[model samples]
Target: MSTTDVLVVGAGPAGLACAATVLEHSDLSVVVLDAGHGPGGQYWRQPAPASGPGALDGAELADLHHDRGTFVELVRRVEQGRAEGRLEIRSEQHVWSVVPDGERYAAHTVDRSGGPGREAGSTTRARAVLVATGAYDRALPFPGWDLPGVMTVGGLQALLKAGGVRAGQRVAIGGTGPFLLPVAAGLARRGSTIVGVYEANRPGGWLREGRAVVRNPAKLGEGAGYAATMLRHRVPVRTGRMIVSAHGTDRVEAVTVARLDRAGHPVPGSEQRVAVDAVGVGWGFTPQLDLAVTLGVDLTTDLAGTPVVGVDDLQRTSRPRVYAAGEVCGVGGAALAVAEGRLAAAGIVADLSAHGMPGASVARDRREVARLRAFADAILRAHPVPAGWADRLEDDTILCRCEEVRCATVRSAIDELGATDARQVKQLTRTGMGWCQGRVCGYAAALLSSGRPGPAVERLISAPVPLGALAAQPTSEPHVE
Candidate 1:
């Protein structure tokens, strides 16, 4: 069986930081597995490999100055680690299932190369596993969210950051929180003629977060930079506003934006129709904890009422051999994720260093991680998914885009069918049973039906695998190379 001392899942800030630190301090071999073809996770998604470190234009630099140095250093660290033979990065390999066997972990992976067939199936055994799968954008369903050219604000940033793709020629960026500011600035940098920037939170809401900003001057500077970029580009940022509906024939051509009340419902006679080629919208992020959940790790509720990986001071999960960091731990940004990754690496190194290896001390790292986590918590408080935003969704609006299930069906299932939870609603109307396997529709369904976040549906595999691949594998033996 192919074995390693540590296995880091994910290639973003957290995973990169974890793998890099472990290789730097210890003599253990580590394998870094990620589904993506490239590194940097989502925050500093690198440009094409050919472009390397010389591809940043003036606008790109302005939009990404917050962690440009971190991104560059991470890339260089990965390059050096691979050269030293202490780190092996298996990119384009999707880790579907990670299970505990004896005293170690068996991570079943499928390489999405050479046709993504049964031939690429294998498992890696590791003494400890670190999950830093990061997060995805969470957008509540609106009247016309299903339309083409309607995407999350993060989607816009991903396109631009990863491949220099613009959001659209003329786009209206509307959402809550500081994330929207970055997306708008990124799209503007990519030459997208932004229609407007809409935020649902009350103006001057960050005054409540004054202490956090005071403590973290870097974070305050980043926010000011984004604001300056938008101002220089003549972008008007409207507060307490949201996109009600995106209108178009085949693609979004315009959006109906409305000033939201304190409850996040549309204000009477306060709607404006802006012509645009696309609409970018999102409220916040949901931690990608499918792997942690599948591994039976304990979950904690975040400020947004979503289940995140429960971790202690050292980023150790309920499961002893499994540690978690980054957004999977919680939707903190790149800096916090990097800090948590380093902390988790320290815990892993200390726990696994019984065989003539030196133990690691995390005292200094713990203090830094705590400070960064506090800033992240303050950011979460500053930009909550406004209460009652779902109340604005029309009864006829489609809730599950995969199944075309409408809001009325979910409401009826909850009110008329005596449904008390999301699973019951899902069974009654098939609200979350679709191609996405409830990843997209689960939160909306739960919020509309029940008050709290729904229970995690036990999933055996985090991602889809070919049926032939599993069927052809030996049931008793580890297929390791």
Candidate 2:
């Protein structure tokens, strides 16, 4: 078992920030683990060895922006700390399970590449654990979404950022939120023909958050910069629009885009087909609450329509010795994540001041957290997922691609089999048993099951069933009733 004063999961902005913050203490040893090859979790991308430092194509910049200052700083600090024998950074380590061990916690990881069949990796035990696993992309199913060239925006971005590859010869980037802009601009800059950008929200929504934007002048500048880049590339920005359907025989060839009515319903006569080789789509984002929820952290619904770990002023959750920061707590931008990471580190420091390294002044940390949280709330409200999105899903469309479950199966489970919840529907049809475990399809499944239109982020982010929760079940039990 490997032990440390703080075990920060994920090497992304939040994890790196937390690790950097904890590294400031000489007495407190810190260990940062990430499933990726290096630092810069989801946001940062390193150029290929053959390519120069700045040789990254346009899509690469889209990811590096999120790596920001604190993220880069964490990488530098970890390297320096390793030389000084104070910190350890473990890369390519995927944590599969985490369990509480008395007063401490044990993180069970797996060596995805290094191990034999189902081999167990080393364990990391720490008095305090900070989860910054970040989030996975949410894929809402539509007709032809399962085509070969159809991919989530994050998947394309990750391909470009991590592997230095492009999505396709021509790509249509459609989604909501600020993420789409950077992706479209990046691909366009890389000489990929970005045919269109279909966003579900109107420009007025950004103006509605004008007050919040003013609070963060740098964020405003970032938005302006992205807009300027997009305008320069002549990428069509279709606000109040959505890709109703993706059309292709074996690969994505075109998409049917439609204008949304004032209530966000699709207008009948506004459908238009746009030719594109690949389609990158997403709704927005949801917090990754698996690790936290597994630790028994309480959850709260965020304005962005995702379930997030409930954290107090200092980013401390209900569980002792556990703290959540960044997108896991809520889908705040990079700046807010940096602030929260430092604030959590301070809280941890204060708790261990006499026993270890001294923490920063409490007053300063509190003020910083409050200001960032307020800004986060404004951004969240501005980017709430559109209502009635499920109405856009076709009856025959594949909802859960991993399980090969269609909207018809989900509807039958709820309407015919009386599935009152997502779990029951999953049990009946194996809807959520895919590789993602329903991270991408949980919202659509819940909406299909409930027959109502509201945010399903809270339900999606709940803890996965513990072995104990399933241990009492009979081996030959019947399907959900």
Stretches > 4 Å off in candidate 2? 46-69, 113-120, 355-365, 451-481
lDDT by candidate, in order shown: 0.81, 0.73
Give per-residue CA lDDT, model 1, range 122-183, as digits (tens).
78889999999998888789888888899988888877776677758998988787888888
**lDDT of each residue in 1-481, candidate 2, tens digit only:** 6878888888777777777777775367888887776677666754333366555543445443643565556777878888888788877677765667766787766544443343334667888888888877877788888999999999888877766678897788886878888788777777788888888878787676666667677767777888898889888888898888889887889999888887877898999998889889987667776677667678877754457888876678888888888888777666667677877777677565555334344456566656666777875555455664666677788988888898888888888999976778889999878877777778677766764323333232233333442343234322211
The clash count for each model shown is 1, 1
Which residue segments of model 1 deviate by more than 4 Å? 47-66, 115-119, 354-361, 471-481
Name the weakest run of 10 consecutive residues (lDDT summed) in model 2. Answer: 472-481
Report model 2's TM-score to 2 decimal places.
Answer: 0.87
| Best TM-score among the predictions, by candidate number | 1
Give the distance in Å from residue 293's predicted Cα in candidate 1 to where it truly belongs. Answer: 1.2
Q: Candidate 1 has which clashing residue pairs, if any?
A: 12-41
Could you tell me how far off, in angstroms, the CA of residue 274 lies in candidate 1 after the best superposition? 0.5
- Kindly report which residue pairs in candidate 2 clash with one another: 307-457
